[model samples]
Target chain A: MTEEQTRENGDAPRGKEKSEQILDAVKERRNRQRESAAAEEKTVNLVVFILDGDFYGFYGEEIKEILPYEPVTFVPGCPDDLLGIINVRGDIESVVNLHRMMGISPGEPTRDTRIVIASAEGIRSGILVDGVEDVLDVPQSEIKRPLATLDRSIREFAVGGETLYNEKYVTILDVGKIFSKIVH
Target chain B: MQTQTLFLLLFTLKGIRFGVDMEGICGMEPLSRTSEREIPIGWFHEVLSLEISRSDYQSPMVLYLQNAKSHFGVIIESPEEVNRQIDLENIRPLPKLMEQLCRISPVWGAALTSGKGEKGIVLLTDLFRWRDLSLKIESKTATVAPPAVS
Candidate 1:
């Protein structure tokens, strides 16, 4: 509020107190606006990878590490998407075949094959990828909702995607949906 | 409530990719090791009638469908991959008209698969119903078959 708005029909001491209160209120509003602008300007970090030759990405905060592919023990009766479990240090983590989950044909593991250890909502698992591309800071505006052409099943969990100037398309997956699939 | 995730074995048959539930799948064997000639005459005809070219019988891969009682083999080009775990929520059921038109349509659903610069459709098979149909074919063949030649 302006100084004129803060003026009151009162004695000098009381008017000073009212002016001081108005000043504090104005400062608070200015601080809130600055915080909101900062929040909007912040960029999102993503970890990008290739699965069955298609580019995919996950929030960088959801990833724990990127490790080379290791031998996994076959677990009977487990879902086919789960290759098996691997020993990540002292911890055993389930490795998921993202290619198969995406309905893509599985490709042979090569030198570029890597396991992405990702965690979301307290659930952690490893996803097998053809290769780890890079970590990028994508502006929020660059990300758009998935198109109508995308299957409802996949589009439900796809948090939109970003297109690079080079025309490379990257779909960002919803990590929570990725880890929440029930194992048969 | 049940978790909608399912384990499926993905394979390509007649140039189109299809997925079948892994629950009823006993295992996959190379056709060279277990030749199509070994299959009984009754079940063999049923397989041939399903539009799969007789030539495909010589394919390299054989997926065995099994329940508690018996097993039947399906000849496919190859076992492309086993999707050990897949969330059923990501699978879309075929349109009502498509299902109604193809009464024996082995595929109950489909999903989109992306590749280099293009996308393709992947059909998902209904494992339980598919096995039931196979058994029905076997039983029908047994009941209607003519006497074996001496």
Candidate 2:
């Protein structure tokens, strides 16, 4: 039977099936390319870190480097959040106590403590964190705006949050707000 | 890296620790044998309006401060150690809530966490500005618009 007659008669198109397989492969690849482009536009790269046993994320583009905790010179006449300035490869950069800035109880710096150097609004500062977690892609659809129940200080610093599959809410910090407080 | 340091004189008042920039301090001495009433430190006299104890009157120390054309002395409880190399950057500026509670600009900021237990937040004050504001307030009260003629 001809290919059209065979399909209408509930029989597979035996001879045309090879060409159909090729067409299906091309269509599937095109669909994959479109979906990949969409995902590339919709997802953001984040450098996640642990703070007080909670996960938080920062834009990967804003982060310069994550270094081991260094002894920062204690300076007076600045905000408590501005812990002190650290010398990072001959560059004097302010190290901030993120815990204090978020109004969380300050903890002792442990071996896992790290300083996340972030640049925003032309200002470079280091954020002291408990531990460096993972670098991952978070879909935009997963992130939600800061909620009313969040602390006002924290809300000011956080751009959005995302609940992961394990039910952990990762708060994304706004680099502009984090650096704005130090500029002055 | 070597950072700029702020020299401060730490002292206690009514169980609270406080600090002031030592830049303006010209001299300091024990208040023993000195008459508190005649003490030239106007700010010290002003603090008397608060609930000061009799023991506080006994061991107070006088700090003579000089800034430009103005000079004054203040009596605080015993003078603690002089922090000669406090990093100026580590000082914590007062938050809006604290500013509202204090209602004074001379109260500069607090010290960062020192990891000590219950060490309490030390209130840092600007010696020069505190004295200047005190003088302005004194001048305002001194210039009593002559009692309205009934």
Candidate 3:
């Protein structure tokens, strides 16, 4: 309405000469929308680790803990991938060798080796790995499907797809499927 | 709350220690002292499908386990007297995954032991399950026996 009223209301004095101010208003609106969209993009925490020189990960919710690898009591009569069972604090958890399960001949464990305790749907067990790399939140949309060329054993349980992080490709593991296959 | 003390007879087969309920344990005696024909004999290694050798059971002794009316003997290493009375609370149930993986082994549960010269997880086995395994072994041996007789 009046020039004084426009100034008091913080409204742009309307006219062709106000083009710069109009552009600023558009920019501010765009930034607000961008921030809200970013806030809406779902993210999930992932526990990524190294296996046979490849990066693999599990959803953070499925991973209970990671402990320094220790000697596991060799359980007889189990498949080779089933390394054995271990004493975690007071609980008895069976450990599976991911390298052997994927048909890779594993070497001796190094100092960085870890036992990842995974619990899904009340079923729990330990997964032996060469080492753990990182635990971070990854945008769910960034995860892609497991490479079609992956071995059948990996494809059998691989899920959540793969994500590129820190210059490495981290394939998400389907922990529930892993437990189901191991159980059934 | 009442605490139950689980009595187990401890032994090792190929250095892999295992335990069995002492309740069903009839006795332990030298293989030479018993009538071998009176009770069927099954080697612990053979029952467990572990690598078996003639010398694997060096100084082997017979551990008798009884069920209901019938009793049987299994060849095992000499009992390692590492505390037969285990706290029932200490026996940990096998992880559900292991329960499915340990189909052939008679392992019902396990106990994590420490100090007093006992360390690591001791596989608590069920001898009666081994007796079940023994029947399968006997049937296999019998199936092969007729060809030898003929």
Q: Best lDDT goes to which candidate? A: 3
Docking quality (DockQ) for each candidate: 0.02, 0.03, 0.61
As a TM-score, model 3 comes out at 0.81
TM-score of each: 0.45, 0.49, 0.81
Residue A81 in model 1: lDDT = 66
Q: Could you tell which candidate, 1 or 3, scores higher by TM-score? A: 3
Per TM-score, the best of the predicted structures is 3
Predicted structure with the largest DockQ when compared to the true one: 3
- Name the lDDT value of residue A75 in candidate 1: 31
Colliding pairs, model 1 = A79-B84, A79-B85, A80-B83, A80-B84, A80-B85, A81-B83, A81-B84, A81-B85, A82-B85
Summarize candidate 3's per-residue lDDT along A1-184 as a digit string, tens digits: 7887997999876664577779989999999999988987789899999988889899999999999989888777776667888998889998987776677778798999999999897888899999999999988778887777777878777884999978888888888887776666
Clashing pairs in 3: A144-A161, A144-A162
lDDT tens digits by residue: candidate 1, A91-136: 5566777776677788888999999998876767888899998898
Task: Output the chain A TM-score of model 1.
Answer: 0.75
The model with the greater DockQ, 1 or 3, is 3
Put down candidate 2 lDDT per residue, B78-141, tens digits, no spaces.
7666853467665665543223323444566665434336333566767666666666666322
